[model samples]
Target: MALLALVLLAQVPPAQADPPISQPAGPHAVGLRVIQPAAPREAGLPAQVLIWYPADTSVSDAPPLRYGDLMATRLSALRTDLSATQLREGRAQQQASLMRRLGVSGQAVLDAPLQARSQAVPAPGRFPLVVYAAGVGGPADENADLFEYLASHGYVVVSSVGMGADGREVEETLAHVEPQVATLQALIRQAPQWTAADPQRVAVMGWSWGGMSNLFAAARDPQIGAIISLDGTREPALTRQIDVQRLTAPWLYVSRSPDTIAQIQRSGIDTTFSLLNAAQYAEVTQLIVYPMQHADFVSRRMREASDAGYGEYSRAEVRQAFGMVALYVRHFLDAHLRQQASSLEFLARKPVANGAVPHSLRIDIRPPAKP
Candidate 1:
């Protein structure tokens, strides 16, 4: 399966330190903390939290978050199994293939400098807060373009990087997701930036393992008004298969229709059937498909990202796939935060030919827009 290849290929990104690329609108100061509950729980481990809010571009005193044993040392161990050159080559090859498929050379966005990553224009006001959690072993920068776009546009979105993958082993990646969610909720309680946050305007998003992380977080976090999952599978986080229906918030599931055809064909109908049998429904649940590969979601880092049997994209699909996800996310967040009546209109948008697909969406009710 491409997912298997993609999972294995995930190990090859170079371990080299990201170059010092600073965002210019501000120096981008940083703060770091660990959220380990005072009490014990199963497989208890400390989760790290990093805050990178708006900073003065002229400032140079910000300290980088330390992955500690996760990134620096553990990745060193993985090198024993996978050579650095091989990983770099794999990443470079994967990236090159994706770009060729996406069209255009160097013009593609990757490894952007801080000045370039920064926004010179100030936000209209303190934007809504978006809390993000990457799936097991997912990188914070994987969905970077989207996160940066939202932040630049005025929303404060926070993401937690999982501990597994890379050359290092983390809290066993998937195993750590639940705690990540717990810690995220805790952080919201512990921090002042959070109380100042808009309660009605918050959203959560994740991809792959991050998607599961996103769902688990939302299931536990009532403050999250909405959620988005990018090509994430549901099997990983379920304690019992019947637990899928626990979700109550608006949800948007974005999957690559053809890329996951085999995966869905193999298990789609069965899962959807069970999803319904389990009584899982949403006030707003919609799935959007793009004519691109699963890996296309990470357009910014296609080299370091790949999957087996994953074909490359043409420039058009790349523009459509990545750009589409961005647009979908922005629209979803705005609909929830600003409560635009038209935005919630999607909850009501569905094909007339509902019989054409095995699964159909049901939006219970759309809330009236804010005054």
Candidate 2:
């Protein structure tokens, strides 16, 4: 029976006809597809995924492309146009501000399952799936640059557009998150290019609010082998989650202290880390708080020159964050997803600068909530 199901599933392609395309799609912009259930599919919530990657080969002798990179030439173009002055000019770091300031002036609605539809450049291929969520009221593609960053490195990154606060009431974001996760898993399980991917090696990442949801999502789904928080700290979602034991996956929760969601000061999220039972903040999980603030984790300033945004760390500091996110996710996923050898440095805990360290993170390995 299982063999028959596999045979039937194999016949289905990764996407439907008139496929929903990835933004900046093509060999030039080409990364991969986010497998999506038809927007109007009669089922519950529809699903979709979009991914980008460094091609099997590059046109020039530039440095090997980074994840979410269009390719060396393209990134170089964006980078070359960037200048220190431009980087410090305006609120470029506040992705929301930058987005609002540069409103979708010329975009045409594209009709997505969740989004109002805006212009998206189409690129396609088989790659890893990196699921992304937006900041508070932020568009799904608001962080395309980041998604592109990961996709270019040879992964299919999906950014789900949930209900927005723009012109509508914000429904519970969780409403559709699970279906999206399911869709992504289906794409991996049934995607045409699963062979190019390490099935066991998928990662869920998001900035701010998305990050919080992903943290909770990771806890709930054991199949999610790795979890990443880009400048997001534990809030009600990660810290005070009701069903604590529902989560057990290894996490790389990275954040900057000053950023709004970076640290939930009121909730005492930091305490969750240090207070966890030794087994809770066990070897499998780790969290790192950067000296920099939230914007520092996003290399947006690196891509576009401007500083009129949340205070920043440094291109060098922000760059450190990018590297760490990629390195850790790469390491964890590679080992678990690809079933291949990878450095466990990411999983290692470094000693504190102060000799008075009792615990690095405060986590309590408590039992599951009563039904």
Reference-based lDDT, each prediction? 0.48, 0.43
Most accurate candidate by lDDT: 1
Candidate 1 is scored at a TM of 0.58
Candidate 2, 1-371: lDDT as tens digits: 99999888865432211112222222333333333445423433223334444444333333322222221122222133455565444223333443354343101111112211121233344455566655554444444455544544456565544333332433444543444344334443543353344455566777765666665566655556656666653443335542446555555555554335644566455544431332253223444545346544443333333334434354444444444444455555555445455345334434232211233222111332333
Worst 10 residues of 2 by lDDT: 105-114
TM-score of 2: 0.53
Per-residue lDDT value at 314 in model 2: 44
Model 1, residue 271: C-alpha shift (Å): 3.4
lDDT of 1 by residue, 85-159 (tens): 765665565456545653432213233232222223232335567776664556545555465556544566665
After superposition, the stretches of candidate 1 with alpha carbons farther than 4 Å from their true spots are 1-125, 164-176, 190-196, 236-246, 258-281, 303-312, 345-371
